[model samples]
Target: MNEPEEGAAPDEAATRDASAPGGLSRRGLLGLAIGGSVAGLAVGAGAGLAGGVALGRARAAEDAHSAYGFFGEHQAGITTPVQDHLHFASFDMMPRTDREDLISLLQDWSYAASRMAQGLEVSATGAVGGSAEAPPDDTGEALGLPASGLTLTFGFGPGLFENEEGDRYGIAAQRPAGLERLPAFLGDDLDPQASHGDLCIQACADDPQVAVHAIRNLSRIAFGRARLRWSQLGFGKTSRTTTTQATPRNLFGFKDGTANILADDAAALRDHVWVSTQDEPAWLAGGSYLVARKIAMLIETWDRVRLSEQDAIIGRDKGEGAPLSGGDEFTAPDFQGTAIDENSHMSLAHPEHNDGIRILRRGYNYVDGNNDLGRLDAGLFFLSYQRDPAQFVSLQRRLSTDRMNEYIRHVGSGIWAVPAGVKPGSYIGADLFA
Candidate 1:
């Protein structure tokens, strides 16, 4: 987030209500300076703004960002009033790299994210739309974009700080709050309610470090998204050894995101995605659809278990997402008989693709450190996309106690009800209950 012209301390109430760019309430901004003293948050802000941080500004040059609105506004229903132009738009990006064919890769990334944005509905930020008109085509299949330099995924995280309201961090605060620490009970949420997720989708990558760079670039766009949270790493769930797919590769060694965004079929695109429209504000529309998650894995403890037992927990081969008995990674499980072979990855036991939770999984992998020991400290920032959170929340909840529950945890979570879009001349929060 950019700095506020004025200064003040952090305020949760203001951020929750006026967190949007040009959306942060002026009244709250003024109160920040005064309240900072009362609440014990004082770094001598710019005089009147609470949302911006003075310290962060003074820090070394970080990635610059520009948050707009969710572009596919006309296609869906918005959840707030529009003080500015409205549409399903938050942030989009060009690739970031010094690699060969980087420009082409960047364009491809933009195209992919933009195409996906077409089907998305207006969400947080200063958007304009409020319907389900956003599009649903994958970058790999739809735009034929390669992961070499393109960011197949784009994302942010749940509020990592105490004062954060959605994606708006206290850019004005001299001292930012919260660390990038994964919560303990952050997994087990299978299907999310209207506003809860914990997923981070990723496949395998030849150069995990390169993937980190790509994610950072994509994160710059997400960081600009005034409505979404940002994270340093995301968990992946690919059965393969490479990382180019949006389908998440879980730490358990599973193939995720198989049924994510719509296939490259023409008919499916129109039915599932959307584009920005005049009905939305000028800035919205042409924005990407969003999927947020709060997934966690039992890495340390899971590692301690025997491989054979692990297979029983997930009901499949960890390396290929195939049944322990042998089959393709993408094959549907029978999930009928007890068929609990000593090593079979049972559908009744694990819900990787079972439990009927159809989400467009797109998340990331993360590592906290070696935990000062030999074990690798890692997990996922699980996220998923859906037309409606209500339709999926039940699906995920069913997996809360899935057989795999023993392999993961559910530490932190909350859902932000994303709206469709809005055109100019509207105000946000108009639909607090709409």
Candidate 2:
């Protein structure tokens, strides 16, 4: 990905009616009232933009610090430096929506996404530029905010091609052979509502609101064509994708993804992460498969366990995150030694034991308030990209007997065929549609 261009602040609203035409649903109109305060800022800009030159400098500094280009050989989020916050959403096409609706939705989303990545408004006549009598083209929330290193990655779920309705998009045969829903795994307390969708967009940014803004505006654009199925807000990324990053910790209080694939590791990426041209299905040649698993942690239960037991279960020391075999965090584990448990998470997930197979992990920690039991409803929103879905499947199957399973439950799961990146004039997924 090339360096990102400096852009302006953000804005957008939600849609109410699933069948609302042109995305001007009742909810969207209600947003115009809710955003009245922000709208005032747009009106006052001509007289005196707040902080004026200072704000412009700040935006410029933000661009230098974090922004990433949206167009690339691969989508930005996968190998781009992991951001601090995430807003991941899944959507389903509205009933009776035709191929044209899907196409237009992608076109609109692409245009808006390209603008938002540069920190620009959703359109040239954005938030306050439209006619006074009409609802604004862009929502007014991110008026002065910088791009915040935001990256938008999109994917197509199996249902997008063919669901119970049968080839609704006339592209069922185009679906990759490996794009089917993930097979059921042990310890899965799956929630039907959160598991799968026709489409998904992963928005990652240094600013939480910026990420949320991207999803909100995109959803509004989909008002009549598609509707959100479920979304997740996450912070404190659990993994790193570049060498400059330090290993981050998970909700489990252990350093996670210590040996994750680095962005510069071309050989590993080719062998494991990105789909190749020689692979089946030409449209997804430069793309890869994505698998998401919402793993809920038993916080109270794990917190009460002895420190020694925790260390044994994870096969690493909590303080320095070193392998129990007596080496630093990055040292290759001596699986031959008796120090680490055979069923430990580290041992089970290590590439050495899995025929050198690896997946690029970009997980995040999430907390969704508290449950009725007064316990925290939180865990890891695990995300991984691989050359083929089977790479993840093989690794996950080996984890069936993982020691960590006792303290976590897989509540949601999904698999998507992420397409190759878009060119300047084309929309995402254009190759498959063609």
The list of candidate 1 runs beyond 4 A from truth reads 1-230, 235-248, 259-262, 265-291, 324-326, 340-357, 372-375, 414-434
lDDT of 1 at 348: 33
Q: Write the per-residue lDDT of candidate 1 for residues 1-434, one digit (tens) a residue.
A: 12211232222222321222332122221222221221222212221113332121221122111111222233211111111111111122212312222222222233223212221111121011111232111111212111221113322223321223332222122111111222223253443331332212121223344344333323322221222222334333322112343344666666554544443333423333322243232222222234444445667787788877776777666677676545676666655544344224245324444444344443555555665667665666544444434334545544555666666655334433222332222222122112
Model 2 residue 427 CA deviation (Å) reads: 0.8
Off by over 4 Å in 2: 4-58, 61-65
Question: Among these predicted structures, which one has the highest lDDT?
Answer: 2
Q: What C-alpha lDDT values do all the predictions have?
A: 0.33, 0.81
Clashing pairs in 2: 8-119, 10-142, 11-139, 12-139
Best by TM-score: 2
Q: How close is candidate 1 to the true structure, as a TM-score?
A: 0.43
